[model samples]
Target: MKAMIFAAGLGTRLKPLTDTMPKALIRVGGKPLLQHVIEKLKGSGFDEIIINIHHFADQIIDFVESNDYFDIRIEFSDERDRLLDTGGGVKKASWFFDDHKPFLIHNVDILSNIDLRSLYKIHELNNSEATLVVSDRPTSRYLLFDDSLQLKGWLNKTNGETKSHFPDINPDNYNKLAFSGIHILNTSILSYMQHFPDKFSIIDFYLSICSKVRVAGYTPVNLKMIDVGKPGSPEEAESLLL
Candidate 1:
């Protein structure tokens, strides 16, 4: 299986620590966040992996080289000249998924115990264009889904902002789930990005076509995750590791 890791973010939320290092290099439980995600993916049967790098791109490249690419088919999608957001990054790396199979995408700063293999299996079984890992965790922004877990819309609770294709969509009628920054997408879904710019958010892309395609959500049981992109999250992630 193949997977792509989103390690190119500016990681502004981590401030001081990220000022000199890429967020992917931030150590949690004595391992770089990138290493954690890589090992997890490898354990889940992923053999080929590509990581996108922007902030301190050289440092990430050096780290991977030092580790001998973790003894797998590891490649780098360099974004040193221009950082592409999630959607654009994936589009740029679309060539890597030439096998025409569904591939998984993961965020470097997210620490989670969700079973990746199971998540991939679910995506294949559903034959969905994309399958996002989500949770009922409270958050300011959420992806709204129907009872069948098909994505319907997105909501920003702080500003009462909602984005949906349905003319009369009611937020109160759908289940609100927090996205986990992990998802699987079919290669066919890339064709839909032809109209998108070089820098776009994956969520926005999903919400724009979700009503027309099967963009499903998978909520894992006992899902424990931490967005290690904030100020004290590294410490918090250590406990998660324990």
Candidate 2:
């Protein structure tokens, strides 16, 4: 299986740590966050991987080279010229997923106990264009899903704003789930994304076409996860991951 790790972001939240190193290189659980993700994915049956790099691009490259890429088939998507957000990063790395199978996309900073194999099996069985991993955790923003777990829209609790592809249905009619920064996407949906901007969130792009396509959400029960991007996350990660 193939997967892409989004590691190009200039993680402003980590401040001085990020000022000296890319977020991908931030040590967590006695290793870089990217290393944790790579080991996890490799153990989860992913054989090929591509990681995007921008902030401290060379450092990430050097780190991967230093470790011999953990003995997996690893590739780097250089984003040193311009930083592309989630959607754009996926679009730019489309060539890596050319095998036509559904591939996984994950965040470098996300440390999770998500079962990648189970998620992939669910995507295959559901036969959806994409399956977003979600949870019932408390979050200010959420993705709206219908009774059948189909993507319907998005809502921001902090600002009381809503965006939906299906205008006829009330936003309140859908169940809200917090996105887990992980998803499996079939390459068949790539054709519709050519018109997207060079930099855009996948959430925005998903909502733009959900009405015409099958975008489902999967919320695993009792998901243990965290976004390891803040300044104190390393310490927190040591406690949780170690």
Candidate 2 Cα outliers beyond 4 Å, as residue runs = none
Off by over 4 Å in 1: none
Best by lDDT: 1
Assess every candidate by TM-score: 0.98, 0.97
lDDT of 1 by residue, 149-183 (tens): 99999999999899999777889999999999999
Which residue pairs does candidate 1 place in steric collision? Answer: none
Tell me the lDDT of candidate 1: 0.94
Worst 10 residues of 2 by lDDT: 164-173
- Report the C-alpha lDDT of model 2 over 70-121, residue by residue, as the tens digit: 8989999888999888899988998888899999999999998888999999
RMSD of each predicted structure: 0.7, 1.1
